[model samples]
Target: MVRIVFVALANLLILVRYLLGLPFRLLASRHRPTHVRFRLAGDPPYRERRRAPLRLRLGGSSLEPATVSSLESFQEALGLLAKDPRVKGILLELEGLEIGSAKKDALVKLLTDFRAAGKRVVAWAVSTDSVGYQVMCAADEVLLAPAGRLELVGYAAEATALGEGLARVGIQAHFVRRGAYKTAPELFTHSHVSDIQRQTLEAFLDERYAELVEAISRGRKRSPEEVRALIDAGPYSAQRAVSAGLVDAMCSEADLPARLEPPRPEEKAKAPAESEAEAEAEESLEPMDTWLAALPWAPVKWRPVRRKPRLGLVVLSGMIVPGKGSGGPVGPTTAGADALVKAVRAAGRDKRAKALVLYINSPGGSALASELILEAVQRVARKKPVIAYVDQVCASGGYMAALGAKEIWTAPHAIIGSIGVFAGKFEASGLLERLGVRRTIIARGENAGIFSVSRGFTPHERESLEAEVEETYQAFLGHVAKARGRTKEEIHERAEGRVYSGTRAMTAGLVDRLGGFEDACRHALNLAKVPTEKFELMTYGGGARRRSLLQLLLSMSSTHLYALCPTCWGLAGFKAGEHFDG
Candidate 1:
């Protein structure tokens, strides 16, 4: 009751603040002109610069949040620019842009659409690596600062093995995996990559490298061979990049306006007095976000009186863990079973929501947790259509949850598959002896201490664990076969804990189609038989709510089998033991 009262009071305070600021907001909006006019200062003395091209900073700090609001707002701004006649063109200022391959492809498609609308799209950057350069390539014209460099280095998949280090410290990992390719346990059990691990990493790298070459070839109007050659001889200077046709020109931010809009012949002949007047009339460039927020209706929150069929979006990101996982704007996030089940059920119960889109960005986690979420998703699918959209990494347990969806749509570069299971525990008996620490345990059952960290697993215990892992793996295969409408044998060929790119997954019958979030949204609408022109998008479960420290500790202490992919975690930029260390 106290908590509810506090929440109500907080909301009341927010309402009061908004009401108090309304008058000033209205006044500011009324004073700011919708459009500005510029005089050429010659024969055409008064030229209307009604909609000076808008400037947008593509990456950097704006994309730091791993939230739906950030992505949704960016997409909304682009939609506004595409539809608004005042937005003649857009200048992209790119910096510190780092994103996954799937997201990069989605962004490239948005930029491509902007260009297709017959509006000029120019991108400027100081220095950038492969990710930023790939995004910049989407622009019609790519500009680089005079002293900047393009570090167009190739892709690499690296893994760190701590088996030897653990051995030296008198610690050992006892694990049982269903498939040879299920290599997550190798991080703690083996000193180096296994034969299958090497093959998997090499194949994955080859696919990504090919995709990069194709993207650059299409963007820069170069052949695949030419793009490959350029990539091989990368780290080019600004002038050299232009000479090599990788960049349009060596330019600065100040010179961007001239490139976007050429000066008129009459403007070159302007008198000092006329030039000053024209300069005063010219409107200065504003940040895209600032312009969006300054719009008259931006501050207002309105709801439609009439109800309409809506597409429900539920995001499942980060590692899939048991219980209710914790996260916020800061710190790491996890896909908790308890939280997701509740969200899915809520979406299912919403009368206005005609279809559901499961946006998954997980690399899989706890087997039981994944199963619980999958059951919830399947329950919802029975009532309405469910479309799973793979963002970047969706492997193992993540893919298991995706099976509940009626259809799976993935970005071309998304990682998918890995239908396998593994379970293990670390033994520190040797370490305890080395430290001269004696410990005693009394268990009622033979296998009661099976998961104890004090001792390693016995032969009988190992056999029992292997049987359980095999059973889980078989169940995973069965689920995939049923979802994909394929025989168990057919699905098994593509299973064995192996992951594939989105394109390959489609070919392997693991995914239904290759597309991005917007495409998935359209498909959901189509499946729901809702009119594409008018429909509502109701998103749920995207917020990363904070959890108490005690809850987090309890969640972390629990033991269970995991249907996870360490390689996928590595691709997501996490080291093997980082999550536990925190």
Candidate 2:
């Protein structure tokens, strides 16, 4: 009886709010803007942008009066412009855009589609790096501020080693890794790069450089050789870029409106009455936020309903770890095993979901967590087809989780493979001794003190730890072999913690196809035998919700036997924990 009354009161409040806002909503709808301007700046949550408002939103509160400018919102605004007859074109203000190469490619393709629909896209940027410039290149006309610069320097990878620095502070790192190319431990155990590590880094840089050259070549209508030469000669000033045909022209932000709307050939002799309205409409572009705010009824807009089959998209990003992961927009992100397992199981039980796409963007982490996620993925695969889509860096345990999927798709330049394991801890006995701090130990088992930072591992303990890591390594190889329908020996040939680019991984049988997220979704639908027209893609467990500082600290404190790729993590601009103050 109480619950019923609460529900009734909630509905009453919603009705009252709707009634009060109806008049304003109607007025705003009548005065809808003629053109939309989208600002593509900063890194947001979503990977792709839509051109218009969604006919249907998949999740989240409908009544919450809040708006966050994300990739999806930008896409929706562009989509609206594409469909609205009144909307003549879109202005893409691309400034300081920080996104991965795969996302850049996706955005470029989106612009291409928009242009194909007879809409013009004018991109304006102040200052941007090579990655941002690549996305800007997709627009019909690229504009830059007079003083802005393009940092088009070629790609380079840097790795930091702390062995010598740790030794100076009377500390040492004792670690064991299974593969020669597994250079993650070197950051602690070696002072400099190993032959294998140097080789691996060089190979990665070469692949990424080649990808950048190709993208710029296609965008600028230049040969690959020419693109490489131009990049080598960069960073370019705005005027220099225009002179070299890298950018179309130099224009200030205030002058963009005049540039966008030159005297139209057919409108030169328009009636005086028409010119006034046209001039007013073209005076300023309306932001998507203002347009959305005007239409409070937009959320409840009516649409035809259909009982279509759904594709479940589960995104596993950041460092894969045990337990519910921590952090969000305020700190480092983690992919918790418990959250992912529950999400995958939920998708498996959902009757409407006919297929699943496990979108992976991680460098891997805890071995146990990876195993748990892979187990859940395999369970879902039995009931519905599951495909893995590698977005950027999927290595070590990240690849381990991917093995559970029936097939894997990867971006051409995505970092894949790294089939290996490593485990160890910092030994601070010397540091303690140097500081004249004495400690006593008490233990109940032979290996009870194996993980104690106060002392190094005993010979017996070291032997035991190595055996355990070796067993895990063998199991990893076995899983990969079983998933690919190959023998352990054949898989072992490529299982030395060595990473591969997406194209090379396909040739190595590590992944089934070279494609992006959309391709993976389509393949999932095809495998499930669901019609594309009658299918809807539903996402699961990709939230980056903030956690308390205490929770974040706790999450980072716990240690595990890792299947992580430190090299990849470092290259991605993450810093691993180190002893002593910086």
Candidate 3:
């Protein structure tokens, strides 16, 4: 009882800590009016807007307690700047903008728009690596902290095969794939990649690498040879990057504001030491916000939320399955056909939905489920514009679903395109014989027991399964060729069940645009022809909601959820362990 009491108290303390630290607005805003104001103050989107020519800090990650930054929040922030009339130029302050290439692509598009309006977009990095450097390259003037370093190593991918581990476990993975280059099974069946797999991987890498080089060349305003040379001698100090023409200037982050602004008639550049000391003195006087001051212990209000409509976002972010979908919040997610199709059809039917963006992040599963999802998405496309955004690892069935979209947008480093199908059965007769266990099965149908683990497939059964796999593969090829407006030869040349990087996939005609979430959102919005930018985005419940301990405790009693899985219960009762071969 005493131990339990202590545990409860600890939980209470943790809940208190989190609630106190929440980002809810605690203080009332000052009611005042100022003339000739640019509303680009460093404030959250929820805060009331003011003047124009916004200044937003982009390099830092989202506020803590939020582990990763959501692309939605970033988009909304950038979208506000893109739409607001008071905002002309945006000064993007970069601290450590560690985001994937998909998010980066979105930033590039937003930044490009900012420039197209004749507004200056300046990027200044305090500390950065290649990912941060990429964003800086998009800015009109790339500024780096004096002590910071910039690393620009090219792309790389590595995979491991676990055939030996399975062999040691006395498990046989018998797989039959249609394509010669279908290498998914090889990860479990081969100790090393096959020669054909190596060739395909090399081709993927070459295409992506060339694209990377070209992007860097264009961003840095350097020749391909110059960018390639820089990549070879990567990880340069700020001074080295400036000397190599990879970045525009090298200055301490403290002096960045003046750098962002033009020199007044009497203004002159000062030394780093004078600037740093002055910056420190000025920063010390800045008052701490009331929320941060009381963060150690404070009460928070959970207010009701208001919803408005903008674009429809349907996310399919897990393995495809063929029943009631098992995903969202906590998950070993299974993207079910029934649930996914419903989401698609709902988006299509919604009159308020100006456009639909299908965000895919799956490696693919269940051919039947994938096909159903594809058909549903095609229906939505017929009504309104649909854009597919492959965040990462869209392969096989995932790729099939993506093709249903009018245009495919992917991050440069995002993985896409795996056109192959296979079937497999585990044979455990050897293990059974070693364990001195006798099992027998009797079936009337010819192929009823084809999947029985007590025996391997007969030659006739093997031929039949192979033929079925081949038919699926051919169907995949035909659909891809037709949708992409490419010949079978052209599609098959890149198929071979191989995954390609986003840029490489675009080159192979497997994907349309090399961009990120922002790009896809904008594309769908543009296709819908949204007259004004003051629109709200609504996201479907295809993701997990991070709940605070307090919220969980408060809702725990009200929440009623239970799973009645009879097969799992029976298996557990039998003490099957890893020895359940049937």
Taken over the whole model, the C-alpha lDDT of each candidate is 0.73, 0.77, 0.62
Residue-wise C-alpha lDDT for candidate 3, range 143-242, written one tens digit per residue: 7778877766765545446567767766666677766656666765787757865665566557545756776787888898887888888768889888
* lDDT per residue as tens, model 1, 1-582: 666667667667767767776676667654332221111011110111111112444677532221223344545556766665656767766665556776677667767887788766777788877776777889888889998988876776666677889889988877888777788778778987677777777776787678778888988999999998998887799998999999999987666555666658999689989977765544344456444444544544333344456778777887787777766655446778898898899889987788998888887888989999999999999998899988678899999999999999988778888888988877888899999998777888777778787887767778778888888888888989999999989988888888898888989989999876767877887887887655567766544444454544344222358898868755644211122110
lDDT of 2 by residue, 1-582 (tens): 666667667667777777888888888876665545677765654533221113465898442121225545556666766776655777788755666767778788878888888988888888877777778778888888998887788776666677899899988888878988787778778888678877887887776677678878887899998998898888899999999899999998767776876758777799988987887666766677666656646554322234457888788887787888765566446788998998888888888889998988888888999999999999999989999998687899999999999999998878898999988888888899999999878999998988688887889888988998899999999999999999999988998798898888999999999986767887898899987654566777656434454553343222247888857654543111211110
lDDT of 2: 0.77
Question: Cα RMSD (Å) between model 2 and the true structure?
Answer: 6.7
Candidate 2 has what TM-score? Answer: 0.81
> TM-score for model 3?
0.63
What number of backbone clashes does candidate 1 have, counting pairs of residues 3 or more apart or in separate chains?
Answer: 0
Task: Give the clashing pairs for model 1.
Answer: none
Residue pairs in collision within model 3: 38-51, 38-52, 39-51, 39-52, 40-54, 52-86, 53-87, 59-95, 329-544
Q: Backbone clash tally for model 2?
A: 9
Regions of model 3 farther than 4 Å from truth? 1-102, 112-127, 140-149, 218-223, 236-281, 284-310, 324-334, 381-385, 389-393, 406-416, 428-448, 452-455, 477-534, 544-582
What 10-residue stretch in candidate 1 is worst by lDDT? 39-48
TM-score for each predicted model, relative to the true structure: 0.80, 0.81, 0.63
